[model samples]
Target: MEGFRLWPGALDAEAQSQLVQAVFGALGTAPLYRPQTPGGRPFSVQMSNLGPLGWVSDRGGYRYQPTHPVTGQAWPAIPQMLLDLWAATVGGKRAPDACLVNLYRDGAKMGLHQDRDEADLTAPVLSISLGDAAQFRIADGEGRTRTLRLTSGDVCALTGSARLARHGIDRVLEGSSRLIPGGGRLNLTLRIAR
Candidate 1:
């Protein structure tokens, strides 16, 4: 009741599958790429974003914008399915200006970090877990930590005390779910980017 939420069959199965198709489809048109860190090393995972503003990371730094860097064109539009999920998941929250999409292949993991780049912490972060399930770990700024299994249709919203809290995907089990064709997980975090 406190840390996470379970939206049992929240996507009605069909919708979930459709969204996955849209995500992978867009990626095929514009594949996800590992951006270089400020220090000039490639980040471990590949990422991309959608909507009015797309989050980007590179040797320069992390920031948000309206176009894809590689394509020099507009980022793929945020699918309506994503918009609907955000509405239902956040309980009427407006459609996010930016949707950060992270693709995790089997065994891929993300380091713990606070999503502090967004302009306002008041607008909570809405995350939807699709494809395979993942072990999501949330660490309080105060040092306490808790991990939960965020599966398909699971909606995780970070707000209030936990807003801007440090968190990350510990690791994704290769074949945790059959929801998606590939043995991977797709996580989408919608936010109001400045």
Candidate 2:
């Protein structure tokens, strides 16, 4: 876990609530929609984005673009709170230009994969967890995998050698938190897309 950093409860409950409101505001412009894999299979999680670029996937393959795939309009600006979080946690010369908003509901889960679709792979991937806790997994340098429960208000980053590390969510612990309406998990992943 040399390149992985976990800050449990980095955001207090009040801050998390504020962030959730901001997320919903962005979603008003760019609503969450399920994305398909390059193979045409639908993902379990619904996704949207904020910032200048939005990460997308389809039969065309994974890539980042300036506008929402469905809305055909530019993505909303990254939330100020998230910008502050990134600055404090993964400070660097450039601010993240893409923030992927993933909503995991029911039994939704993500398969292990590396976040290498960005042009700036050197920039660390900063993730904020809200609502239900997720069983997060990441591959270590020793070729082994480590798992942890990422709960609401927790913030984590994948940087350095682990910038392209294979990581994913195994399953979400439902009823763990009530931050999200109707009960689910929201994962906000900030990264440099271009």
> What is the number of residue pairs that collide in model 1?
0
Model 1 C-alpha lDDT per residue in residues 1-194, reported as the tens digit of each score:
25344465576678788888888887765568777767887766678887789888877888897888887777788898777777766754466888888888847788888888888867778888887888888887677888888888777788776776788988887787887766688888889887
Cα error of candidate 2 at position 117, Å: 0.9
Give me the runs in candidate 2 sitting further than 4 Å from their true place.
Answer: none
Worst ten-residue run, lDDT, model 1? 1-10
Question: How many steric overlaps are in each model, in order?
Answer: 0, 0
What's the CA RMSD for each of the models?
2.0, 0.8
TM-score of each: 0.90, 0.98
Model 2, 1-194: lDDT tens digits are 67898999999999999999999888999999999999999999999999999999999999999998998989999998999999999899999999999999989999999999999788899999999999999997666998999999999999998888899999999999999988899999999989
Per lDDT, the best of the predicted structures is 2
